[model samples]
Structures are given as structure tokens and as C-alpha cells.
Target: MEEKTYKIMSGSGIMNVIMGISAIALGAIAGVMLIYSGVKLLSNRQGITF
Candidate 1:
């Protein structure tokens, strides 16, 4: 019983760590994309007219 509990807890901890890393990677990618888009818009601002 204790062994099973320890296995389950270890699995859960590993999954949580994996998910945390993935979330951070996803957030970093999104942030980079946003910055790139902003830079593109600024660079092309002269071509846009109201």
C-alpha cells in the first residue's frame, strides 16, 4: 500500500513538472510571436493609410 502510494505520488509529481515546463515554453513562444508581430507592424506602418 505504501509503495503504491509512493509510485502514484511520484508519477503525479513528474507529470506536474512536465506540464509546468511545457507551459513555460508555450508562454515564451507566444511572447516571442507577439513581439515579432509588433515589430512587423511597426516596420510596415508607412505602407498603411487611413
Candidate 2:
């Protein structure tokens, strides 16, 4: 019984870690995209083509 409980607890912990990492990665990607868009807009306004 204890072993089964341990297994379940470990599984839950792993899932939480995975979820946290994914969330962080997604947030980083979103931030980069936002910055890129802003830069693009400014460049367009300046008539500088990339």
C-alpha cells in the first residue's frame, strides 16, 4: 500500500514539474514574439525594410 502511494505521489510531482516548465517556455516564447512585433512596427514606421 505504501509503495502504491509513493508511486502516485511521485507521478503527481512529475506532472506538476512538467506543467510548470511548459508554462514558462510558453511565456518566454510569447514575450519574444511580442518584442519582435513591436520592433517590426517601429522599423516599418522608419521606412527601414528588413
User: lDDT winner among the candidates?
Assistant: 1
Residues 1-50 of candidate 2 have per-residue lDDT tens digits of 99999999999999999999999999999999999999898878867657
The C-alpha RMSD in Å for every predicted model, in order, reads 0.6, 3.6
User: In model 2, what is the error at residue 6, expressed in angstroms?
Assistant: 0.6
lDDT of each: 1.00, 0.96
Candidate 1, residues 1-50, lDDT tens digits: the string is 99999999999999999999999999999999999999999999999999
Give the lDDT of residue 19 in candidate 1: 100
Q: What local lDDT does model 1 show for residue 27?
A: 100
| Total clashing pairs for each candidate | 0, 0
